[model samples]
Target: MFFVDTIELAGLGNRSYLAGGAHTAVAVDPPRDLDQVIAAAVRRGVRISHVVETHIHNDYVSGGLELARVTGAAYLVPAAADVSFERIAVHDGDRVEVDAGLALRAIATPGHTPHHTSYALEEAGAAVAVFTGGSLLLGSVGRPDLVEPRLTERLARAQHTSAHRLAEELPDETAVLPTHGFGSFCSSGQAEGDHTTIGKEKAGNPALVREVDTFVAELLAGLEDVPAYYAHMGPANAVGPARIDLTPPAVADADAIAARLAAGEWVVDLRGRVAFAEGHVAGSFNFEAEGKVATYLAWLIPWGKPVTLLAESPDQLAAAQRELVRVGIDRPAAAAVGGPASWVRDGETPVSFPRATFTDLAKHLGDDVVVLDVRRDSERAGRHIAGSVHIPIHQLHKRLDDVPAGEVWVHCASGMRAAIAASLLDAAGRAVVAIDDPFAAAVEAGLTAVPR
Candidate 1:
């Protein structure tokens, strides 16, 4: 019997897989933190014999190299990938025996990247599952524009052919397991359902049903702003990511925290938005532990700048550290485990901002208050308050002066991003109120204008 275990990186919106027969297994697209993958192998009582990548990832650092090193397993990468390290170069039609009666067959899929490949898990000469890395997702394929801009359209056309090739060649019952599309920005569109098969995708996936021209046109039209940190990920993966360090950072006393802030280093607070809004160290930013800390912090912070962390407890700091390392923010400069009181110097009062809802925003709509919409352009295109100033959260740090002068009321799809923006505005000496309510509530309160 063959078993597959999924390792979900919910913060980054991707999934990695571990599969094989009872005794040995193969890991596909593992994340930087190998502890979880190692623990999963222990629970399954299987020795991992191979670690493979579909392509050089553009989102998070791959744990494949480190995992293979630790397990003494063969590290398998696509033959066409221009990676620096030595790896077992996998090519089309190549087969690697995973266990006594199980093996993996490589299929060149080449759409998500020029060297992307899919691996089919075959048991007793019958294919049971296929790991389609970024090519064939649940409802859509991976975006093609992450690579060189000149190759985008060509790659989009390739995606259509690749999706069709899988559908035509694989049996309808072959399980289609993909590494992207759970909510990852790598997907061209929102993916549907938790699981799917070759038969299901043929019936509904856009890449399968639409003509190549139509598919490419629509895909290009719908692409949104790429995350800023993505520019660094691909190069890091190509050069081979170094082994990560997750030991707790040096504890920062209030004096050290103050000095770091004075030197322009980021002091991030990993607390819930509500607690952060109530109180926080002046000039520190809030990236809640309860939210997508990896995605947002990496996206917004100036690359290579020093960062210090403040968490309510030791466990919160540890968890946030794990999340940050996966995206290549390897080690925090310093960390503190306590509330704002302990993070601030003696006789200094922690800064604070107010939390309000859209209803409160409604009452002050026509006053001297500036309604700031920090959602993405795509999100605001759907609907927004008529006269609100727009700036995506990722761009806010660089464009703080673009915000009009007034008491600013900020909001996003949910209140998390609004809180982050609120903290930024607060640090800039602006009077800001975080709309700590859902955007749906804005419509209910009759605050949004017609959709553009």
Candidate 2:
């Protein structure tokens, strides 16, 4: 009885897996938070016998070490990974028998990372599935530029080859499960669905459909800016990441938060965009706990800085903490769950910002307000408001001084990035109006659209 289960980490747009025979299982490419994997194992009534990684991940911290430690499972990592730890070093063609009827064979599929590998789960003698990791995604191959700049082009070529190899070697019915490149920035392109088969990828994946040279050229051209936090991931994983601490951080009262603010530490507000805009602590930046707090907050926060989490409820704070730890941001310096009224009662005044619609901004187009576009370069390249200043939201923190002096109107394709940018600019004490509406509505509102 072979089984496969997917553990979706929505915020990071990645998935980990549990696959094995009825009595024993293997966990693949898990996030730093290990409880979910443990829960799945408990639910399945099986012991997690092996913890394997397809590669040393660049998008999030790997929980393989901690998971293996806690479960007493054998930690199987690619032989090529340069790590200072003890475990089974697996290479291509290496096979491990998990139990009587289940076995896993490592397949060398080096594209997403230099040492990246995929694993094939075999039930008896038949292939049950292939954990493709970052190699072959549902609709596209993993981007190879996560490593050094010199290796990106070479790795792109390898990615194309790897996808073809997996398609050629694996049966059509073999399940294809990948860890990254679904909607994650780790990949050059987005995958269409949650799950895929080897035959489906072989027939529809663009990398497999195109010539090697053409695939390489297009992949390189399509590569966007990697998150700034990616540089820390490889190093952290190589040296063994610290065990995740899910304990709620110490609660900070108003005076403590204010003191941290005066010391220039970060105080992130994980509330709704509208609620945050209506009123929030003067210095806290709103990240909306439901959004991509993992990617955005990890990208923006200064490394090793004291961070304080502020949310409207204990669940929101815990959820934010879970997302944060995925990207190696563990144990915030302090946290508090309350609303604006709680802070106000402590003799602190909350501030409010206006979240305007695109139609409202169009009315002031000719005024002294500067329209700031904070969407990605690829998004803005398709269609954007005419005469808008372009600065991708990820780079906005460093380029704060570059914003023109005036009342600034900010927006992204949707309201999310606009809200994030609004919080940032507001924290910097800039007069900002967040345009909270859909881009299609903006087009219908008579805002001039221009191509890049």
TM accuracy, model 1: 0.98
Off by over 4 Å in 2: 344-347, 448-452
Q: lDDT of each model, Cα atoms only? A: 0.93, 0.89
Q: Which candidate number would show the highest lDDT if scored against the true structure?
A: 1
Q: What tens digits encode model 1's per-residue C-alpha lDDT throughout 245-289?
A: 999999999999999999999999999999999999999999998
- On residues 216-260, what C-alpha lDDT tens digit does candidate 2 reach at each position? 988888888999999999999999999888889999988888888
* TM-score per candidate, chains pooled: 0.98, 0.98
Window of ten residues with lowest summed lDDT in model 1:
183-192
- What candidate 1 gets wrong by more than 4 Å, as runs, is none
Q: Which residue pairs of candidate 2 clash?
A: none
